[model samples]
Target: MIEKCSGNTLKEEFEDVFDDVLIDIGPLSVYYPPGCINRQVSEQSRKKKILRNNYLIKRNQLVLVRGASGSGKSTLLSLIKGIIPDSIFAVIEGRFQFVEPSANVFCVFQNPYSQLVCPTVKEDLVFTMENRGFSQRKMAERLTQFSNFFNLFHLLENKTSKISGGECQKIVLASSLAADPTVLLLDEPTAFLDKDARDEFYAYLAKLKGKYTIIIVDHHQEQILSLADQVIDLDVGIDIDLGKKREHTLVSENWGMIRGAIQENYCICIDKLSFSYAKDAKTQSNFCLKDLNLNIESGKIVTILGQNGSGKSTLLKLISGVLRPTAGNIVIKQGCHPLAPKEYCRHICYLMQNPESHFLFDSIAEEIEFNYRKRGDRSGNISEIFGYYFNVDIDVDVDLSRSPLLLSEGEKRRLTFLMAVLEEKGIMLYDEPTFGQDDASCKKIVTLMKKLREHNRLQIIITHDEKMAYSISDIVYRLCQGRLIDEC
Candidate 1:
């Protein structure tokens, strides 16, 4: 049975469990200094921050932490991992366990591409094993096993630069699992995948149920709710609770009549589209997409589904004008015009699956205002919007100069969404918008999409969540072998 203990007793217990390798933080508090003019700043004037108040993570449990964007989830993780500096953030009271100096702990970051730093897949996997003093034969055996298990064998000899996002993500998973860590922390591992690939990925994870201590921060609620042994809700600040299963029913009124309006207006059209990436001298060239014809209308949520490398995101890029088709023309009806890549930025906002890259400001407040200013728009009543949408009060008097990069993963995602909304674009393309959120946050996102649709905005979402696709979309399309097939 799980028991809550006082801070001092918990620290002592953690040290005993971890054999003195425990990370202890007492009354920790962090702050960011203001943007100053050539002078050092005082602690009192800095922005105050608090990660957790007397928090404790139990050993060897499949724990899932759920929180909205910018709720300090990532910071908490860093604190537990002993990566954050004591001087910056004050640890109110907490202790984290690590068995030994070489204790097994692996963290899969939100962006799989960022984690890949080696030349080739083999070299990347072997590098870690080699550093751990594993023999060549043993390393090779483990590499083969992991690669085969994750279906990454096909890309073993290929350059890391040439793999698709899904393939790259699988490689990261293989690398993390190859280490055979006692605890595995996953941050939105299936964010970049299509429906089939996401299903396969989750199946692989389900097989590892009791083998390791798993902690996943995810936004795909329906997929993980049944599997989660415990769900720590962080909606407010540091509210942890056990997960209880509840039956979910479809809300017919949730989607509203926006879909019917989209069918009447032909906003976007594609004719026989095809695209291919350049191939290396040693390998055969491959077509990412071929002979795809589709049309998207305003007010409708169109979902494109497929497996990994099936051109789902490529299709979204084609529609959003980020990519040009090698062989077909994209035609916009009279009311809409085909925008160039740069012009598309102003008209078509693409919310990337990985929200970390979307941040451009130092703080969440600044990030929102930056987007507002970019669009030449002003929100005189910012408090109303924040209260209605974010459920947070904005301190207009306080200067928000902290870096957005320091926010939690969920917060980053929310900030990105806010940025897109502030753009007031005619068409919005969301590539896996719900990556690292909880059940409540996921519902809020759906509600936000509905609000946008009611305003007559053309919203196209690329998602792996079949339930979400069916719930919000007016039309659904499937991509297979680089071809688009409509699902009636």
Candidate 2:
């Protein structure tokens, strides 16, 4: 629980929760200033070095930040959280004075896996309170209160590692709120959630209007924008005279319509497969997929759909050879005898939900080369095709010499998904392909899947995105209560 500041102190810092501007940025701008190493910036990295000046917001306001993938959306939040010139290197051009300092402000990261600590949800939520000197009884009281408020009472005892991506996000939010923050900042808060889950979260956020000064940086902002009193564009400031109107709605590109019918011819077969997680394994897969007989067909997109903690990702792992099945096997067959996922790496490529899970190189160019070399192909035309078809506005033109890990969350997703596409494997398995992408970027991915289908390749996606499943999938398989069922 937040320690109650004296009434005099509250009156000193916070404005009338009614009429005060909680944050004031006088000439807020950032630049590289001068650096010894890598002073040269590429077309993509150029925008990352600049932030439009004089972005302002008021108290009890929800400010939504939007831009293409690499356009400094995340960087702006980093600046506010004091992660910029204070921690990471960057030249600050202006001043940011908050009604509450860093202690009373909470910042959530884009990667859920990195943001969490402690093994169980109970411990993770209490760790911060303990650090703040709260009593054990007080910690338990607040945990129970916030858990109920956040609809997480049922999950308090679960292992944090076993929870789904969406569930993890909920725990992060609950833990942050337990700090009694006057300001809450979230970066891509709903990147892991589906349409239904996002809507549910938006509802929860709306109720916190006057309680906290909320600033959200997200690619999926359509549903949440209704709650935003201010919308800031990092690329361009809040300038109505510059073609950005305050009333404009941010809509994602809709590709719910497909051009042609799909044909079915089995390309991979899963014969009675099951898997269980080893303790603290290199990867986390708690739920199990058991005795699953499945067939993946060419010219069709097969999707794995389920609620959180249903082993949807585990099923993909079994197919990708990340997790060996407890019983049964997976076989890849194009025109030859069946081969397991390990033996048929050339025929299939798996893109993990966490793009960084598969990274093996230090630079973007090297990572691209590693992708092709691992598949035993030396094709040099991928860079060209990637440039030509890369319609994403997320700064795909970044310096190829930089590490892939240096790219923004959205850019990383694009790069990893492209690796599978560029290899042009007969079968590709994508786990949460739409994880960090905005609307237009998601449409581009869907369009690419359509093209792959036309080329008679097999595409299988594991996702919680219902819109994407409806847009690109030809068959949907649901993982329910440890069972995989073919729904359509």
Tens digits of per-residue lDDT for model 2 on 244-351? 322111111222222233333437788877666754433324536667788877888998888777778778777767677766777777566666556766666788
lDDT of 1 by residue, 1-488 (tens): 11122434455755656442223333333333343321233322433233344444445556676665544555555545545544343322333434343566677777678788899988877666666678878888999898887777778899999887778877887888787777778777777666666777778777887777777777666777777776755434322221221111111123331222323243778888878765332222366787777777777788887787777777888777777777778775537555445566556788887777787655656676676666454555544544444333334222234465654566567668767876677788988777666566667678878877877778888776777788888888888788777875
Q: Highest TM-score, which number? A: 2
lDDT of candidate 2? Answer: 0.68
Local lDDT at 406 for model 2: 68
Q: Give per-candidate clash totals.
A: 14, 2
Cα lDDT over the full model 1: 0.64
User: Each model's TM-score, in the order given?
Assistant: 0.77, 0.79
* Clashing residue pairs for model 2: 69-394, 274-326
lDDT of each: 0.64, 0.68
